[model samples]
Target: MSAVDVSLRRGEREILHGVDFAVRTGEIVALVGPNGAGKSTLLAAMSGDHPISGGRVEIDGRPLDRWSPIALARRRAVLPQQHSVGFPFTARQVVRMGRAAWARTPRQDDDDRIVAEALTTCDVEHLAERPFPSLSGGERARVALARVLAQDTETLLLDEPTAAMDLGHQEEIMQVVRARADDGHAVVVVLHDLGLAAAYADRICVLEQGHLVADGAPDDVLGEELLGRVYRYPVTIGRHPETDTALVLPRRPSRASSPSAQP
Candidate 1:
């Protein structure tokens, strides 16, 4: 899937400038940026959830608008930052909804198998019968993820999927994302954790104020200069001694030394 000169505008305010990027099959790309930088907005546009004011988005060389809604849902699945059904639904029922895109025939056994597999893949099999609204934040997040997994789309777009999870759960989610990419699906995720992005993403695209600032390998895009410039903070980028992955740490101002003391 690819974005071809995609630009989105909400009224007079533009959310995404003429941004161009692509996700090759079997690769994972992470969109990293500060708040209001249009990371989520860009994903929404690419997933056909938001309309573009200029340019067009194409999936497999075909314009997004040309595909039927069911066809689009089958090819690409999106998990927004927040989801709510506003009613009590069993986790299994919620997951079954993902199969609606392909449920042309009455096949209960197939649906059950798909839902079970999705729950197991997401490590939420125990919560399958629980009501979605009654589950904890992390559990609910996992259930939501399982729904997307059940969709079995070739392209997956996730926005801040690990925000409500703990460290362990966060790592688990990243593992799931990486596994999906390894299975030849294009995966694009908006991640706030720089370390996770560096570890999991094959490429990192940094957005700044609705503009595509940097698009390259994580080592190049997550440098100290880019962090300090785009995030407005002094940050140090170093390699993890054990895992050999990139690590980012914010540099604190020295209390003993005043800014005026420097020549």
Candidate 2:
């Protein structure tokens, strides 16, 4: 999927300012920026959920408007930032809903198998029988991810898939994303954790105040000076001992210089 010079307006205020972004097959592109930096807005535009006042979104070399809803759903799946299920449904049932787009099609017969595979891939198979609402935040996040995976689309647009999870689950979700990208799927994820983005993502795109500031491989785009300016805080980047990838950490003020230590 590709968003060419996309600009989106919410009412009178514009959220995204002509951002050009794309996620190619077999690539995991991580969108990283500070809060209110228009990451989610860009993702919405890419998914066709929000209207763009200017520019176009294309899928498989065709404009987003040219494809039918079901046809689009068959090619790409979006997991929005806010996913809530009002109905009382079990995890399995919730996941099965992803196959709705394929209903009445030949793939309908493979629903059960596909859903099960998605559940296991997301590490939520154990929660398959549990009520979605009753599950904990992390569990719900995983189950929601499973639903998206069950859609079996070639492109996966995930918005903070690990926001509510613990460290273990966070790593698990990243692994799932990594596997998907390795499997020749296009994956775009919004992440606040720069370390994970550097470690797992093939490319990183930085946005500030709705503008695309930088876009490149992790080593090229995740520089300390650039990130500090974008995040409005000092940062330090180092190489991981084992992986040799960039490891990003905030530079905190020392106690002697901190405000709390002032007279």
User: Each prediction's TM-score against the native?
Assistant: 0.94, 0.96
Per-residue lDDT of 27-135 in model 2, one digit per residue for the tens?
Answer: 9999999999999999989898998999999998899999999999999998877768998899999999999999999999999999999999888889999889899
Ten-residue segment with the worst summed lDDT in candidate 2? 79-88
User: Candidate 1 on 1-263: residue-level lDDT in tens?
Assistant: 88877889898898898999899889999999999999999999999999998888899899999999989988999999886878899999999888888887564448878899989988899998888999988888888999998888999999988988999989999999999999999999999999999999999999999999999998888889888999998899889898889999999777668786676
CA shift at 226, candidate 1, in angstroms? 1.0
**Which residue pairs does candidate 2 place in steric collision?**
none
List where candidate 1 sits over 4 angstroms from the true fold: 105-109, 254-263
Clashes of each: 0, 0
